[model samples]
Structures are given as structure tokens and as C-alpha cells.
Target: MFEEKRSILEPAGALSLAGAEAYCKYYGLKGANVVAVTSGANMNFDRLRLVTELADVGRRKEAVLATYLPESPGGFNRFCELMGGRSYVKDELLCRFVFPERPGALMKFLDALSPLWNISLFHYRAQGETGANVLVGIQVVDTEMDEFRDRANSLGYVYEVETRNEAFQLLMR
Candidate 1:
């Protein structure tokens, strides 16, 4: 909107238009007349996410979404069955991440991770209201765990290591 109209819109200002667009896309509506009454009151980019959060989830699906799975190939099949869909690792550290629903969040995460460490497990789903809870499994040796933590912390997203989680031990190890 700012690029085309040269006007900055707060989250509330663009909410109606955003919702309308989401509705159109989710239902695959084409060549239809729609109206949106947009209004704003000095909001920030953080809250601007809520505009789409209220958009019946079509737009939200565009963001990074994640979930965990078992390491065995059979776990993949079981997971798929559980979700009614189809679905690795040594010294793999599990971490849950609050991935923002922004455009570059996924790439940002991969850019930080892929080149340096091996990603053993990854699950993503785009249905979060605020963002996706991305669970990433990485092949980080015990000695490198601290350095890995530092790298993760520097990514500007909230994350925590789940190596000691009992469910992870039973499911992955």
C-alpha cells in the first residue's frame, strides 16, 4: 500500500482490505467486486500482522508453519496417518521456534542454518495467528551446542533447545 499509494497504513487501517483480499484468495474468487473500509491509528509493523491474523487464515497460511516428526521412516507414515497426510538424526538438538509470519522469516532461518549445520528434521505449518511454532532438528555435536545456541539466539526469534524433553527422547531417540 505504501509503495503504490505513498501512504503508510497502520494495522487497523489496512485490516479491511487485507481481510477482503484474503477472502478472495482463499475461496479462489476472481473478477468480483468487493469493498473494504480501511482505517488506521498509528500502529506498528508488529501489530500489522494482526490485520491478516483476522483474515480467515488464508493470508496466514502464507507464513512459515512447522511441526515435529519421528526419525524412523515408519514415524513418517504414522504422522501422516495421524494428520490424515504423509510425513532423522545423530546428536540432533530439537528446538521450538516462534517464526514470525513475515515473508523472509523462513529464508532467514534457513540462511542461518543450512550453510553451517545439517538440518535433520523440520516441520512447518502456516496456520498460526501470531506465527508458526517451527521445530528444527540439527546435527550439532555436544561441544558445538553452545555455539549453536548463540547462533540461534542471534537470529532475533524466540527459541529453546528441547534435547532434554522427555517426549523428544521417546519419539526421536
Candidate 2:
């Protein structure tokens, strides 16, 4: 509610949107319309902090993370103080692949290329038992793009590179 309307909703109201977001995220939904029925008009000003902090995280403008810290005093403080990670990664390739929804389809796809490249992200879209699509984010150095292409071709699934999709760049980067 805050992200869209700039109004706060009680916890119950937020849950509907949260559930919808989770479902869309989990299913890699694209260009789909969703409806979330929110309830409860009870508002508290204190809850604004959580909305301000987390809304951006959900929108990909900010990051909220959980890390395992040593079970010792000051662990939480140390974790909070640390800001670490690579600024950018240029080798990731995003591809959309469609495969028949069958018993061996997923494992077969995995077997073809999983050993050759580090898969940074994998998402599946369900289409009942008819077929499915996957959006894969695999890391391949420039020098190895041809080899990666060959391996991807050998998988025999219909696929295309979507690394340059503007919406993806804006939303998932």
C-alpha cells in the first residue's frame, strides 16, 4: 500500500500484497495482472519505519540481508557495520528457456550445463503438466560465450537470451 498509494495499512492489509508479490516472484510471472484483496484500515505511525525500510528492498532499490554471525557478543553490531560485496558483475547472462513438462525435463536441462557454468539464478514458471519455462541467470565469461551457446543448444529446449530486456534490467538488477 505504501509503495503504490503512499498510505499505510495494518499488518493484515500488507499480507495480501506480500503474498501476491511472493507468488509472482516465485513463479517468474511476466506481464501478468494480479489482484490482492487487502483488509483492515487500522493504522499506526510506528509501522512507517518498517515500510520505509522494506519497501525499497522489495522494489529492488535497496537490499535487506541476513547473514550468519558468530555466536558471540557484538556479533549483531559487527554485521550491521559491514557493507560488503562486489559492485557489479558483468558476466551474468539471462536466458528464457521452454521445456516440456515431463519427468526428466528438469534434470536433463540441469545435467547439460550445470557443470560448465555457475548458475547465479534459476526460476521456473508452471503451466500445469503441459509445459514450463525457466529464466536462468548463468555466469559465462566473454571468452566462453560460444562454448556456452553450444552447450545451451545441446540442451534441445527452446531458449533465448533476455539479458538485454529493459524491464528485467530495471526490475531485477
TM-score to native of every candidate shown: 0.50, 0.49
lDDT tens per residue, model 2, 1-173: 75467667677688988899889999999789999988646655556546555666777977876678899998876775576422355689989999888889988888988888888888886554657888888889999999989988988889999999998777564
Q: Clashes in model 2: which pairs?
A: none
lDDT of each: 0.76, 0.79
Candidate 1: which stretches are off by over 4 Å?
1-88
Q: Write the per-residue lDDT of candidate 1 for residues 32-83, one digit (tens) a residue.
A: 9999886666766666555445443544545556788877769877876787
Clashes of 2: 0
Give the local distance difference test score of model 1: 0.76
Over 4 Å off, model 2: 1-88
Candidate 1, after superposition: displacement of residue 21 in Å? 19
Q: Which prediction has the highest lDDT against the true structure?
A: 2
Q: What's the distance in Å from true for residue 102, model 2?
A: 0.6
The CA root-mean-square deviation of candidate 2, after full C-alpha superposition on the true structure, stands at 14.4
